[model samples]
Target: NLSVVVIDEAHHYVGSLGASFQGLLWRLERLARHYHARPVIIAASGTIANPREHLQTLTNQAFVVVDDSGASQSERTILFWDCTRDPKTPPSTQAAYLTRHLIRMRRSVVVFSNTRAQAEYVAMAGSDRSHRILPYRSGYSAEMRRRVEHELRSGSIRGVSATSALELGVDIGSLDTVVLNGYPGSISSLWQRLGRAGRTDLDALGIVMVGGDPISRSLLANAAELLERTPEHAIAASDDTDILTRHLLLAAAELPLEETSIEDGPGATAALSDLVNRDLLIKDGTTYRSTKQRPHLGTPFMEREASYEIHFQGTRDHRAVERISIRQALREAHKGAVFLHFGTPFRVQRVDSERREIVCIPETEGHHTQPALFRSLSQGRILEHLEPHPTLGIERIEALVVEQVTGYKEFDQQGRQVAKRKVTSPIISSPAEAVVLTCVDPIYLGIDPEDLFAGLHALEHALAKVLPLLTNGGTSDLASLTLRNGDAPSIVIYYLTKSHPSTMITKVIHNLHEALSLAEHLIAACSCASGCPFCVLDARCDDEVIDKGAALALSRLLGKISVGTALDSSGDEEG
Candidate 1:
């Protein structure tokens, strides 16, 4: 009998999906009680906050947490090297150059790239300079990966470029350096990758080479914030209706759940009745049980990480191809686009959305593809409204978002636009649970109506790039919409997560004063004069060019209101 269960890398299990291992742990707890055997759980994560609460929620048990480390530590050196956007050389090329230099200095190194293709490119470039470096990613066979790890530890290989697949706690002996090709989306992930070096308490170096993206550039400028942040709390949607229904059905199948015995949230009377209507369960007065036709819930009790399979020739050989998330496939796998698998390039022939698959063939083209997207947000009904500040209005809303990949733009090695091709694909729509914030009377703050609109647009773009820093969600995981309210002169801002009905990120932003403070701090601290990429400029904006000065003016105006504004002599506003 299993008496203990240990989960490593616990942060990976936290996701927006309603389903999670919590249900399975609940079942295990029930079974253990029936058998009179207690199970002890130990979950370890390098970047998890609220460990005690997270553990209790996952296992339905009360336990003490021992978080302090007993191991000794040494001082580590972290360096941030900011590069110009649209640099003459790509970030990958720079990463390769640095890795080669470190290897020549006889320092063992691991370079972390965001994508497999990037990992491959970095590895290849480093190898051109020095032959002792190699690529290490997920696509390689287990034996091959083991061999590479052995070589890295044995000093046969001086450096290895990798993706997040190698970011976990894998033993590779003592190392001297770690290189980050780009910001890894979250402070937790950044620290975890850096922790891979200096394991032995030996002095080590961690280099962060910022990329051209807004997130990287923002982080590059605010390097101290990255190092000073506490890890984000890991959240699981245990009370999600869809997830609860599935688990409740499984609980009934497990051992005939007594209605009064289970917890109130997921196992309430109304939930059971709803399941009865679906024919998945039967209620016999006070007790409920599973149907005889199917007594087991085959869908595993874990967060569902769904992916679309890429078919080389309609064969299911996992080794020959890679799987990408459905969201990514929709955005990047449209016809005429280039797909990169483990750093190898392929041209997409077709995308079968119905089958959740993409068909592609080898490509000899020396260009990368970028999707040109058309997106819109339908008006939503307000479920909850709040006036956090006299000038700020907040609302919880339900809306629909449609994204269409209208075409793609190709770029060559020189960062020059090569070709633009149109794609005739159906629009992808999804329900959006959002929080809307409306700012009042921008014209009274000494800004013209046209500039007000441009300013709002620029603020929305900047918030979309900056919100990721304050929350666990990445920039891709969040979407926003900004426009002047048709019925009123106020500007409305909507922030939506691609997952979950409600998110802590939105809850945090509901504090208008805090949100405005962060926005003002970001803009005021940036050195860019007219909104370059490091400030408010958005390369992905399809509407119009943003007015940087107007954006700064609007931000300052909001800040004034948040800080208690008063009417000035001209009847404008002063704080």
Candidate 2:
């Protein structure tokens, strides 16, 4: 019999992970009811702003939060290293140099990167004869991860570059220094990563290398405000249709689900009916049973589309290197792309869609590949609309997004474009949820038509980078598209996931006014005479259309609109 359930690192209970865990808790409660036993849940979180509320949302039960710590405290020093001050060297290069310096000081250090590719790049760049820094991320093989863990514990490796995968409560011995390559999405995450060092009573040092993103740059300018700001709230929609559907299937397989056992929400009822219609569930005497054996086997905790297996082509036999999601495979493991694993480069030879496998050969060349993508969005139904200001209108819509990988560009070891080749790949199209921003008239900004479009493009780029900081989501979680509807220009900020309801987008809509204000500050704070990667320009943007002055003008015009004001009450001319 279960009496107490302890959830460690409870802040991770957000997004799909939180939804899956919530479903498990629901089942556990049902089982306990059958046995007439009640279990007390104790959730422990370090850096959540609303710990009690977050846990309640996760488990559907009330919690009494104990915020104070009883353990001994360690003296820690957090130093902010602004990368904008030193623009001559790249941020990654500076990170590698700092990692090497920290290792030379005989202090064990962990350098945290925002992405897996950046981790690998830092590890490869920081490796020297005296010490070899390795990359640790989610896509690596379990065996390789275990080996790295063992090495780190035994002090065999003094330094490592990793993504947020290492920020959790993993036992990887004690660390002396923590280097943040960039601001990790939110304040809670930033503090969580900094807490990785000095687990014991030993004094620790944390270095944050601010990147060129709008959020990071803003934090750099207002360091005091950032330090004093409260952490963002964590959110998870347990009643989301796609998430609920998967969990309901798993619950039915665990024990026959009755009307009394499940919540009678519209989404739940529709999911149940859809399952029965698809022959995945059988209805018998007011109960539903899964037709398939162990339905949980097919459902993963994390929501993802199809996946592709990467295999190393050895002389004698092929060996599985790692498995990657289909989206990542399209961008990184496309045909003729150079894939890096454990600091070793592999050139992809073939991407077999039928077999769902990517075969690669070890490459001795020093080059990288980046895919060129084209994205388009079709008309969608508006679910809600709000006009915060007379000139600005925001709408939540459901639409279909089509993404195509047109070709790839090859870059040499010196970060110079060496060649560009076209490749034939399947188009990816799926349903998405988006928040569209429309202006009453583009003429209000008094900018040329060409520059108006360019400013809109720049604003979209800046918003995509800045919204992640406010939404508690990553840059990959949201995407932006600019559209011109006659004289009015609209920017569509949509989720990257397919057919899923995300609280992140909801937060974006609620905080759209704040986001615009931040964007305006970011554009004005930038020292560049025109647009640059540090402000409005995106490094990933292949198009060369961007205008900083025009974007600033448009942003100022939009920011003037009062939030929460009704469109009818504004008494302004509409487009």
Q: Which numbered prediction scores highest in lDDT against the true structure?
A: 2
Cα deviation at 222, candidate 1, in Å, is: 3.9
| Residue pairs whose backbone atoms clash in candidate 1 | 117-343
The runs of at least 3 residues in candidate 2 whose Cα sits more than 4 Å from the true structure, single-residue gaps closed, are 69-72, 84-88, 211-216, 256-302, 314-320, 369-373, 378-400, 404-426, 433-440, 444-479, 484-488, 495-575
The alpha-carbon RMSD values of the candidates against the true structure, listed in the order shown, are 7.6, 6.2
C-alpha displacement of 469 in model 2, angstroms? 13
What local lDDT score does residue 279 receive in model 1, on the 0 to 100 scale? 84
Q: Please provide TM-scores, in order, for all candidate models, with all chains considered together.
A: 0.73, 0.77
Tens digits of per-residue lDDT, candidate 1, 46-143, equal 76667777666666677687766554456899999776754887677778788888988889999998776577667755764345677788746677
With a 3 Å backbone cut-off (N, CA, C), the pairs that clash in candidate 2 are none
Model 1 lDDT vs. the true structure?
A: 0.68
Question: Which ranges of candidate 1 are over 4 A from the true structure?
Answer: 15-19, 67-74, 104-106, 115-117, 124-126, 129-158, 211-218, 265-269, 292-307, 311-319, 349-359, 378-399, 407-426, 433-441, 444-479, 483-575
> Positional deviation of 229 in candidate 1, in angstroms?
3.1
